[model samples]
Target: MNPYFCVMPFFGAELSSNSNKITPCCLLKNNSNIDEIRQKMLDHQQPVECSVCWNLEQKNIKSDRQYKNEAFDFYLNKDIKSIEEDCKKGLYSEQIIKIYTSNLCNSTCVTCDSYSSSAWSSLKGIKEKKSIISISALAQLDYSNIKMLSFVGGEPLYEKINFDILNYLIKAGNTNCFISIVTNGSVKLNPDQLNILKKFQNLNICLSIDGIGKRFEYIRYPLKWDLLLKNIELFKSLNINLSVSYTISNLNLLYYSETIDWFNKQNLPYNHNIVKYPLHFSINSLPKEFKSLLSIEAKHLLRKHLPQDDAQFVFFVKELGLQDNLKNISIKDYMPEMYDLIQKNI
Candidate 1:
């Protein structure tokens, strides 16, 4: 087996939209000096900070780094050694910049908190100042061989700085690089923004919708269902390859069929990203016996509806088993529909 060497740093850098912290992936957050970080990347040493991928890899599961390796090969079309040599020196060369800094989201998703969403701060009585990654800050980075830049939010479209970055790239004539914007699909891009967005080498929009109809409104609280559907239709109308990011929790896991049917009808591709934070709202919070039953049922659904995802079935069970504590929430009060489904399954 090949050693776990992730060459992303040779070509990528993920930034905290709210802070100056930078790391290889969102799963790992580190405070090491930039020099040390670069050296570690060049060494191909799997640091402790990348435990998220490491854990998944230990279980023989594909990780973000694996996908990124394939992506690097396709996008850069350069040997890893050449990139490593550059990193070996103090100089930094970044191609993929995945930023999540704008705290200016309008909706307060049940799965997100104050740290990630400014709207959550106001709703929950926590206070936070809005932050933006100014063009000057980004300019400091070497964008010589840039291939992709991603903006994730609160909601990227809601912040003006995100638009500014788009304009910077377009004006700089860096239109051959891909741009990905992760949003709640509640906001629409204006004509001017859309015109420039279309100029990007490839513009991919990842819609973060947890459920549909009332279920969606509940999970992504304060969401306008009609507006969301309309927004999605607008992107699809452009023949854009829309991707769905479903954050599964016990609250909506039983509604698997509803989500599956919705995706099939729209012909939208999706991946399940189980919510493990705010433990009270996670599937791992369910009683072990309850989780066991859910595990069986979830696998059955996958087998019937998504046979290619046998590994995903194991993920659901393994993640639940790894969770140490269980703190039940008021599921019935929050989602009577899903609540009743669980009751029936009982």
Candidate 2:
């Protein structure tokens, strides 16, 4: 068994920003690197293209590589040895599909951009809505061997292509297949959409929550805190699997402890993903003095992730100030403590 073996390269497909391109995983920067990653894993060499997972693993955090390998191990009833052999011989079947339908989303999140959110695109004067994935291209794949289908979008719930795929799966009698959607918790599922969702027995709804109350509103602008809670209750009523996808960023670092406490009190299970794009939003962008005021636990966790260069931190301050001005919202109002610390230092 190769320690670097991951099931993603052999058994999973991810839609890239381009409609026709499919890569091994979303974290893989270059689609062309997929084959190289597979070859490296088979040779027991760590692929540099998989730095996201490697960084997490180095930080003593479980990476997507580990989680996917574990999940597929159970699904296929195969150990690492058999999986490694299958890959070595170029024998494998796709069992997982992750699609990013389009950038048609409702909220312009602080950590998000025009590529993933239509709201952000509109704000930036980008017209011509387009799909990152081709629905017809997916139809060509064999659905029989599929064990998991995950969708992320501008907002999957609001994307018509998501329903198009779901309808296709339903027609193929693949309702028993595990389905997961990462949503922003802003859109309510209409009766028809709710009915379609109810057909799936294994549905995992992962809500993207960054902060609680006004902080959440500030980060996910044009979204009401009350609406999010109401929608959460609505999903919970379905009795399906629910989890939180909490994103960690410089803007939300100070609120982490309290926000996590909120999740714990609600008995919501969560997984945190460190933001890397829009480098200013990265936790590493926080000034040294601001970080010194964080709790010991937060400080320790921050140590796991690499710190950004000073230039990026300077960029972050400038970007936040610009956005806050444009949005007519003040970070000082939503995140007073961190704002004060930053003001004192920078």
Task: Name the top lDDT candidate.
Answer: 2
For candidate 2, lDDT tens digit of each residue in 17-77?
Answer: 4566777687777545677778888888999888889888887777889878876777667
lDDT scores for all predictions? 0.65, 0.81
User: Measured by C-alpha RMSD in angstroms, how accurate is candidate 1?
Assistant: 7.3
Judge candidate 2 at residue 21 and give its lDDT: 71
How many clashes in each structure? Answer: 3, 0
Candidate 2 colliding pairs = none
- Which regions of candidate 2 fall more than 4 Å away from where they truly are? 17-19, 77-81, 303-308
- The best candidate by TM-score is 2
Q: Please give me the total number of clashing residue pairs in predicted model 1.
A: 3
Q: Each prediction's TM-score against the native?
A: 0.76, 0.91
What digit string (tens of lDDT, one per residue) describes model 1 on residues 1-346? 2354566655568877666666756665656454454566556666776665776566555566776666665666665555455556644466788877578898776667777778878866766777766555677655445687888987987877777777777767777777788888898678987776677757778888777887777667677789989988888777666877777775577666678689889887765565655555554444433444454445332212223233333443343233211212244545675555445543
